[model samples]
Target: MFDKIRDVILEYVELPKESITPDTRFLADMHMNSLDIMTMIGQLEDEYDITIETEDLNNIYTMQQLVDYIEERL
Candidate 1:
């Protein structure tokens, strides 16, 4: 799941795959703004066949948090 999530993120960002760890922050570390985050979320929703609520996003900042949220929905 982590690998899949990383792949989805890779489609939007140019960073090396190795640098995207569970602790990497979408905002602070990857410098993803609102549009970038929403675009990535759309991809993820399509890839995982899950709907991620906007309110749920407030608590998610790191890669692991996103992974965990998707896992729980699945």
Candidate 2:
């Protein structure tokens, strides 16, 4: 799942796959703005067939957190 999520993120950002870790911060480390995040979320939803609530995004910061959130819904 982490690898799959990383692939989605790569579509929006130009970063080496090895650079993105579980602790990588989407905003601080990846330099993603709100729009980038939203776009990625859309892809994730389509890929996993799951809906992610906007309000729940408040608690997600790192890669692991996002993975966990998606896993929970699965």
Candidate 3:
């Protein structure tokens, strides 16, 4: 699941796989904009077949958080 999430995130960002850890920040570290985050979220929703609430987006700020969110839904 982590690998899949990483892959999905990579598609929208230019970060190296090595630099992307559980603590990597989507906005601060990756320098992602709102569009990138939204696109990543959309991809994650489709990939996991889950719905991510708009409010929940703010709570997910790291790779681990995103993975945990998906795991919880699954």
- Compare candidates 1 and 2 on lDDT and give the better one: 2
Q: Over the full model, what C-alpha lDDT does candidate 1 score relative to the true structure?
A: 0.93
Q: Write the per-residue lDDT of candidate 1 for residues 1-74, one digit (tens) a residue.
A: 99998988888889999999999999999988898899889989998899999989999999999999999999
Task: Please state the error at residue 8 of candidate 2 in Å.
Answer: 0.4
lDDT of 1 at 31: 88
* Per-residue C-alpha lDDT of model 2 across residues 1-74, encoded as one tens digit per residue: 99999999999899999999999999999998899999899989999999999999999999999999999999
By TM-score, rank the candidates, best first: 2, 1, 3
Residue 64 shift from truth in candidate 1, angstroms = 0.2
Candidate 2 TM-score, C-alpha based: 0.97
User: lDDT of candidate 3?
Assistant: 0.88
Off by over 4 Å in 3: none
lDDT of 1 at 29: 96
TM-score of 1: 0.94
